[model samples]
Target: MSLPPDIADLLAPKYGLDPSICTGPGLVAATRLRMEINGLDDEFSYYDQLRQSGEELDAFVEELLIPESWFFRDRVPFDFLKSWVTESWLPTAKPEVDVLRVLSLPCAAGQEPYSIAITLLEAGLRPEQFSILSGDLSPRFVEQAREGTYRSIAFRGEDYVEREKYFEDIGEGLIRVRSFVRNLVSFKSMNLVCAEDYADDGPFQLIFCRNVLIYFNDDARRMAFEGLERSLTDDGVLFAGHADAIFRINDDFGRYGPPGAFCYSRRAKSETEDVPDALPKPQSKPLPAIEKRRRFFQTSKVAELPKSKDPVRLPSADSLTEAKRLADSGQLEDAERICRERIDTGPASADACFLLGEILLARKEVADADAQFRRTVYLDKSHRDALFRLALLAEQRGDSREAGNWRRRAANRAQPSTSMTNSPST
Candidate 1:
């Protein structure tokens, strides 16, 4: 049996939430909660309230969107992404001024975008050379993505060592993203259904819309694909979910790799006729330049991080503070230069090496940055960022054993380091 027509119609069009899969009891339970909150007992009354108030609908949408994402959820696409960036992307890029723009729509609780940032970092692209723009239909998820923190469950299948690399265990099992990875990604609230949301934003180098299309009806899927097509650059690639391979539907994209990978490259427009959409497309135009948000998403900008009163602090920090300031201020060259100077003037410094590694990362210099990060861990075995970067580098290169080893090492070091002072014979 299907949902009552009104509820089904209301949900399907706006959010592409298929009634068939979402099932019955789940909808009833969720709707019941809304009814209780609004003091409406009847289903139709609640549906009326949903129709009358936009806020209620948004909240309902949030309830419907269960974000089930993990870093590199299925490893193949990222492996493909790493290969594409190195083999296809970098060679064609104007690295000096043209930043590699990537978009992750529905950046639920931020895993995908953060994964993108970390993956790109692992690939050794400098922060300045790439920028990740993440958006979600739920403002709440968008805010969460901005904060860049996660619980241990977020890293469940992953090695603990890998977790130690990008996150700091503030307390409990919660972890916060390091500034290096966080800096590369920007989060915004967007409705993929509303074509206006992304009209002005991109013709991105890469776009990830994984696992979302499964919920959409045929027409909604077509609309989503069309919108993606609009934002994707002629040479850009789209990363999709495995279960719903995009190749089955569209003539617009040529399958880039093996089945289950879900990566596709846009066909030359001339080679393919404009793919027909069941639904009418939204008219898109550029928005005013002034409306664009240029500032980095700090705690205040979006402010929905899982709050920790007692944050864990690591030692061996020095010019990194200033270097970070320079980098954030867009003085990347100066940041790199000063970090190098710090390394030169200092005694075998792991902090400086890590900083240089980060600087090199923002520059998209992967191999060099990998070397620096490796040296960092050598100089100071407890350097978590370096350890994590090494893991990412290994993972990208398909070295699961090395990645696992580094992850294990990072996990070991994440525990509070104990100090032993030399004393006169006890």
Candidate 2:
């Protein structure tokens, strides 16, 4: 239950993760899996392997880090960028100014940074007028972002006008960002807490780091905030998630611009204030894990997720296969319709619900996706992939006990579900 304190302490310094952020059991479970995969039986052996193998450590960090991201995720921040650039940035700036620099931390699969490009372009900012520096802790995520490929799930708002204007459909469910947008970003793999890893060439006018601070412990939070502060110009604005109010957490930054912008500007020396006595350390209050799992766009060995438990009067096998293809190919709506029709006709179609759940998730409708995954589980108690997804979601959201409970159930379910091993989880 205590989750091997040694491992907990070991990870914080290396990866800058709080036990509360990864949640104790996910780290332990992942570590155990890492050990077993590497042929190490004991924790000591695994620890030794970790010291000898940088790859192993990378693999471990990959498991614990959730790289969920979407284009225009939450929508408001992109709108804020558009407003700031057109109104404040463009108006008061000199025509001879360098590219209006911006940063997107934890830019999962390039969505946020790409979205920023789209917003600026839509607002008539020429490609040469702005530059986006995108970074993420996960090398896998950084690589994916550089690829510039995405799916319907990455498109948060239903409107496809932007997609049509800025992206080229690459078949199935994949969308590739156009060259103009892709050219605007410079992607790098960097950790937030490692000040050394930060680009010395910063002072970005705006930084979009939504939902990242809430994942850090207080020390790590301070480190990350300090890094951001150092990276920004005095007038630079930080666009954070609404849930983690900067003023409430740290007084070094003051509210900037609109009240609901979730934006902050560095405070002058005289403006510094103290935190309330009642507010707990951020490490103790890590945000709930509504974050998406690191989904590798269908190329990995683990891409094909599990099949449903048991089904009655299910859709034709061909139809289900077609549905998978549709979802994978990027025809999410068609895939959803087919899955729903199957479920409506066959109420106990766990496979249909499972398929639908994956589609919803791909569309970035997380709460709906969560519901569908739960439905798949209810219909088929032994649905390991669904259980694991739920478990990961629970863990990320700060419900450590629930996360552990679901994880245990998932582990138990795994032994018997060998046939679905290559099916989706991460």
Candidate 3:
């Protein structure tokens, strides 16, 4: 019952479900039962495999639906959510209408919805004033959400303290959520891609759909957007992944705050007129020279180059060498500043760009780091350090294919330099 290669390829991109799960011995009986139920022929094509095999299809669906989330996964988005609820949404609510509904679709084992509940509770919303509707396609996750149990390993950083405060020891390395937060949320099994079942719960004021859309293809993304649009109130706010943007995907939404962050709002009539009909114009000035120097030391590689012609420029080699010295001496911010200053003086310095990317990546400014890496590569394709860093960033973002491509390019470029040294002709 081996699947055709083309079918596997098509399915692979959409869902990271391991194909071996289907070919495995344990699933054979289940697979056969599924095929028979759907009246699929033995000689059926790849699409038929998807239609016929319930077990395999379930595995695929699970991949698309699961998301990695933790309590307060990204603080900024939660902070904004808290502020908006306290200052905006709550004030606007009619006093006569006591129930404030919040829905976390695909709640993914309950961390997000619980986080929302905690925020509301902290904001002084009484138990009756607010309600959390948490849903997911996985019955297992839904059950876990109901139990509100978590292992110590699932709690990280500040979450460790929060977990201890909000949960009671239930034995066996599990902790049960306290009554206060638990009472705020109601768990249900839901498939967000199919929204009819939840139509009665419509028009949420705020929807936390973060980090879920990255799994979907364009059409699925569109469908999800439409579903959200239908489910949201007119002034409702939707929060998506830090890296995700609706600007390119949907005209119905508008971006807010600085670029490349989770802050966005529903498109306003006046805002729509302000959006340029074309791509945003590029920035006029080069990044600061100090920032370039900061970036250079972070990577610890000098771009191969004709050095800058400016005589007043900080001693080029010494500047980088000193920046590295400062970095090793535990002066990270200082080293970064030096790199930035170096880049501002001249745009051709890929060394500065690579260093800046490294510093930014270290600081957890991933999007900014990614931009610096792109700049480094654009300036010098042979920049191995930039290529390596870009590969690492891509891998972190769950894009292994892009990671592999960058790694291969780096390896190929590194090879030629090594090969030339061993040649006798030189």
lDDT by residue for model 3 (1-426), tens: 444566555554444334533332223444456556657656354257675665666654554334567787766566766666676556655555646667788888898898888877766677877777878877778888888888775566775235556778989988777987787888888766665646567656667787565445556667676677666554456777633445557644654322222544444334314322111111223223333433543466422221113222333656665665665565668877777656633324677667666667667777777867766776688887778887888777665766787899999884321111110110
Positional deviation of residue 407's Cα in model 2 after best superposition, in angstroms: 18
Q: Model 3 — TM-score against the truth?
A: 0.59
- Best candidate, TM-score: 2
Q: Taking the tens digit of each residue's C-alpha lDDT, what string does model 2 give over 1-426?
A: 334566667677766675554445456677778877888888788777766677877787787665667777766556666776776566655556556778888787888888888888877788777888887888888898899988777776586244678889999988899887788899988888875565464756778888666556668878887677667654567888743446546555554433235566644334223211111111112112211111221133322211223322335767777877777777888877777656533325667777777787767777667767766776678988788877877767676777788778888874442122233232
lDDT (C-alpha) at residue 10 in model 3? 56
Please say which candidate is ahead in TM-score: 1 or 2.
Answer: 2
Q: Which stretches of candidate 1 lie over 4 Å from their true place?
A: 36-45, 268-426
TM-score of each: 0.59, 0.61, 0.59
Which segments of model 3 are wrong by more than 4 Å? 1-52, 60-66, 159-165, 257-261, 269-426
TM-score of 1: 0.59
Score each candidate by Cα lDDT.
0.66, 0.66, 0.61
N/CA/C clash count, model 2: 13
Q: After superposition, how far is residue 312 of candidate 2 from its true place, in Å?
A: 56
Candidate 2: which stretches are off by over 4 Å? 1-3, 22-48, 257-260, 268-426
